[model samples]
Target: MSTVHIVGAGIAGLAAATWLLAAGRRVAIHESAGHAGGRCRSFFDETLDRTIDNGNHLLLSGNVAMMDYLRRIGAEDQLTGPSRAAFPFVDLSDGSRWTVEPNAGPIPWWILLSGRRIPGTSVFDHFSALNLATANADATVVEAVGGEGPLFRRFWEPLAVAVLNTPAETGAATLLWRVVRETFGRGATACLPLIAREGLSQTFIEPALTYLEANGAKIAFNRRLRAIEREGDAVTALDFGDVDVSLDSTDSIILAVPPAAATSLLPGIEAPLESHAIVNAHFRLEGAPAAVIGGMPFLGLVGGVAQWLFVRGDIVSITVSAADALAEESTERIAELTWADVAVALDLPASPIPPCRVVKERRATFAQTPAAEMRRPGPRSPLGNLFLAGDWTNTGLPATIEGAIRSGEAAACAVAT
Candidate 1:
């Protein structure tokens, strides 16, 4: 039996191991962090006295890879969402509220209905998305879709930033169009928004670990890969700071670490070098449970520092994507600024802020711009026995759970062949 030495215990590595093990291959996972789930994990915050995810992510039903991974780990029921595709948004500047509700079929008849479309946007404005069909590699989100308009302000801009984690003015239009094609283009059934019912760890991590352990997969924490020893066209060994792992002819390697760490280990590897920041603020509601967003647990916000707000019980967590400037602010200041928006969006008093925990991920994701998209490498590497898996890899998708999981599956498939 050949043993596959997988580096990194994030979702990408876990997904790779899961697929390999299911194919009757031996697998071992090595992670630098003590725990799994990298940026998508949950932790107990003493300040809030609750378990909160390091980041907030929204998954659509169209994410087939993510759904398959969850099903493989027996966690298909761990997510919760509305029965229909409804995204409720609030404009803090004017206190106006609306919900973008797509119909059940592929035909977007919802756009014709004023109540289901973005407020003040004409039907022709909605059709402007067709402009992306002919967008070239150099086209940006603002270029493919008109930059200034009620539709751009209320729909395209927020969707681009949330999906790409970069400003829509320069973010790749092709990437955003790919997302639209997969989700919104498919129909309301595919665009249904879903979030972890309990926490990220419980839903995506713990169950995966359990499944892997039950199948005799080796999982080692704090075993960071510092260097790769190459002999001819194959990787001969992996060097950790304290130990080394020798690879035989049958043995293979899969690198599932971040782009920077992978670049450090394998110099000259093409990967997205630029990254953006994301700021997530979790606050514990004092008086009562958060007034849900149109009977949902999350709400989209515009004209505020925050972009998305998720309510889990008494905890209200807000996500600010492409928040390079906000990420530089002090935690106290971030909490204050986001809370003010949260107050208005949630219809709560703004004076005294509740117990809040601010988490700033400096390199949340690669800058999903036109140039950065060109830097993404595929699963197969120069070495015959080595492969790569991560959202940063060329999965033809943004750095999302679906993209990460798909990358891992692609690497595992490459290894099998």
Candidate 2:
């Protein structure tokens, strides 16, 4: 069996290791952090007496690779799906609210026929999407949605932020096509949202580690890889602090670290370096409503302080995507703004705001700019045995959990080949 050395214990690395182990290969994983799950980690909040994730991550039924990975690690049951394909969207300016539901068929004919969901939008509003869907795969999202329309501003813009983690003008059209074609285009129910009922560590990462351990895979924590040595087309060894760990010429290596870390290790290699930020605010409430705030797991915010809110028991967490403006805002200021929006939307009685926790990921994802899109590297690197795997890699999609899993699977396949 071939020995595979994977650097970075993030989702990508863990997925690759899991696949290799299942295939009866020798594997060793090195992570800089003490624990696994780089971005999708969770920890116990002693003060709140509950588990909290670093950030909220949602999955769609279209994410086959991610779902498959979960099953492989024996954590598929930890995910809960909403009853229907619906998302609540609220416009704070006018106190108007609407629920966008999936169409009866695979193609979302409701969005094209019904105007109630997307208020102030007409059937023509979705013409651009249809046109873009049939356009050349190399086209950009900006080129597709160039005209001014309410749908472009409210629907497409917010959707772009959620998917690409960037504005529609900068996001890639090809990637969006893959998302729409694979999900809504394939089947109406394929877009149903899946959320983790428990913490991410419990639902995804920890189980993967357990499976790896059971398969005799070695995992080293706080072992930061400093450099790589190559012989001909293969990577000869890896440098971590004072140790120079050697690898067989045929042994494969998957660099699953973040883009910045990857670039630092391989100075001359080209990889996208653009970054986007995500700001999340968590509020502990005394009591939540009997019926959940709308039937949807999350809601889109337009012209509101809160972009998306997740109601986990009494703790209400709000997420702000592509939060460049909120980068320098104080936690107290953000909490105040977000709570005001939440109170209005959820009809909360005036009460003293409970303790608040704020999380800011400055480099949460790569900027989905056209220039940045071109820089995303594929699984194969210039070095034959050294492969790349990460959401930031060229997975065709944006920096999401699904994209990360796809990249890992691609790298594993490359190693096997």
| Cα RMSD for candidates in order | 0.9, 1.9
Error of 2 at 373 (Å): 1.6
Query: What overall lDDT, based on C-alpha atoms, would model 2 receive against the true structure?
Result: 0.82
Off by over 4 Å in 2: 112-116, 134-142, 290-293
Candidate 1 Cα misplacement greater than 4 A, ranges: 287-290
- Model 2, 104-211: lDDT tens per residue? 587657865565448888777777777668655556676887635777767777777778777677777777777878776766578788888877888889899999
What root-mean-square deviation over C-alphas does model 1 reach?
0.9
Q: Against the true structure, whose TM-score is highest?
A: 1
Residues 238-259 of candidate 1 have per-residue lDDT tens digits of 9988989999999999999999
Q: Residue 20 in model 1: shift from native, Å?
A: 0.5
